[model samples]
Target: MKILAPVSSLSEALPLIESGARELYCGLSPAAWGKEHGDNIWLNRRGPGKANLADLEELEDIVTLAHRKETRVFLTMNQPGYVKAFYPDLVSFVRDTLSIGVDALIMADPGLIKRVKEKEPAAVIHVSSLAAVLNSSSIAFFRSLGAQRIIFPRYLDLRVLRKMIEASEGDLEFEAFVLNDGCVFEEGFCHVSHAFGGAFCHNPAWSYKLREISSGGNKVSQVPAGGESFQQNVDEYKRWLWLGIKNFGGFPGPGGYPLGMCGLCALPELQALGIVSLKIVGREASLRKKAAGVKLVRKTLDLLEAGCSESELRERAGELKGVPGLCRSGYMCYYR
Candidate 1:
């Protein structure tokens, strides 16, 4: 199983490739786009300026360094809304960036796909998780548009993913998340905004704040967001607390440290099934974390290839995870 990782900066390129990242993906927010959309309103799924490389020149340097190590680089254009009005400039940017020697364009927007096809027909398009591809037909739809690979959504279980692979029958390249943060809802379907300037999902303070507000700050929270009554709210709070204690490795605080999600335990199974890539999520993750994640995945893949049992892989993965130990719940796993 090959490891595909998200690169945030030029410095990460060599270290990540050295750490065992054979494939890398990143987002670039040109100066012009940043000026207009500000920081939060990103073209891709992540927040601009924070999760992206701003200068194409620097991106080119990183790409070149990665290529020297035989690592292929993909650029994510996973914007949900890039309207026709933005086409001319958008096409210009894409065309220029493609000229910088990117290996593929990972995206979710059909309009952007169409535009990329029109401008750079030879482009290899990989559908992003934002596309929420749940089955073979959805894979076929993107395949028809020249998408060669599909990063299946986070919600898919092992049963369904295996079914999808069987249904595809060697027609598509399948990538799955191996490690890092996870979400509480379907990424493509969630209407809830994540910070940027609102009551977003990333903010863990919501749990406590909602509890207090639900009770009108009287210490008895009423109608716990989705549930009814103070007890139900209290139960929900306890559940979150329990989840924090179980999931977020070392950073077991209220925020859960990027919401405390992981899929390291699934690596042995995924590798057994011959998964094309195991992705480590975190475009804005720190350099140490980036290298450590890649190293962990690399070590696990090596252990698996050497015929390590699932139980053994699980133990090593927990050691790497470093906190909120064990894979006791499907909620914390990336592909349980």
Candidate 2:
């Protein structure tokens, strides 16, 4: 299994590369968050603490660094519809990034996928997990458009995932989220955008809303829907969830809302089954933590490859625990 870590900063890049991360994924700037950041960088105004033109240059530096180590850099264009609708300028952003020649672009929107392919046919496109690709039809649609990989929706259990893999028949590479949080919504079915006037920023559908509510010294926003907040611009919402926000962790899976990080130590057993990538979440994670995560996954893969006893692997997995988020169990479908 190959390990892909999320890189929020150039600082996070090197250590993850050294620790055996085969790929890294992240947004270009605050616009990537859409309306969540609320600073209008997507509207072309300056966003506070946002990645700038300089940041893209720095990303080139990171890409150069990763290339030296033979690692891939996956840029996220995964915000459900938040970035594209709100930041139309993003068309150029996509063009520019592909021009820079990073490994692949992870995308969720079909229109965006069309646009990206139209402009940069040479750019590798990976279906973002936000696309909620639960069926083979969805898989075939992306394959027709030349998607190189699809990040399997986390809501899929091992059985459904296995079937999807079989159905793809090796036409598309499959990537799975092995660590960090996941949502309950069918990847593309989230309604937060429509509900919030694109202000709340979850899915690009324009069905979500954000009410400004006060919480302690700072104001906090909530996604009554799912996945919008986490996928949008800004960084690391998990810290707040870990601090006891019930909305993120109260659910058991990705049905109503999102749940927290999934621990997939059990996933290594699937390697022979043909999953291409084992992905970690949150590009915003600190350098040390991301690097540590990379090392942990690499070790896990090595042990699994050696045919190390499952008992031994289980012992190692005991060190890492899974957390629950707001996704209530039993609700299997996104809209129902």
Model 2 TM-score, 2 decimals: 0.68
Cα lDDT tens digits for candidate 1, 123-206: 888898888899878877777777788988885888888877787744678888877666666777776764453325543334
Candidate 1 regions with alpha-carbon error over 4 angstroms: 36-41, 195-199, 202-259, 323-325, 329-331
TM per prediction: 0.82, 0.68
- lDDT (CA) per prediction: 0.73, 0.62
Candidate 2 residue lDDT tens string, 72-104? 888877755555554446667776776676889
Candidate 2: list runs displaced more than 4 Å. Answer: 30-54, 82-88, 184-187, 191-260, 320-336
Best by lDDT: 1
For candidate 1, the per-residue lDDT at 169 reads 43
Residue 320's lDDT within candidate 1 is 54
With a 3 Å backbone cut-off (N, CA, C), the pairs that clash in candidate 1 are 214-222, 249-323
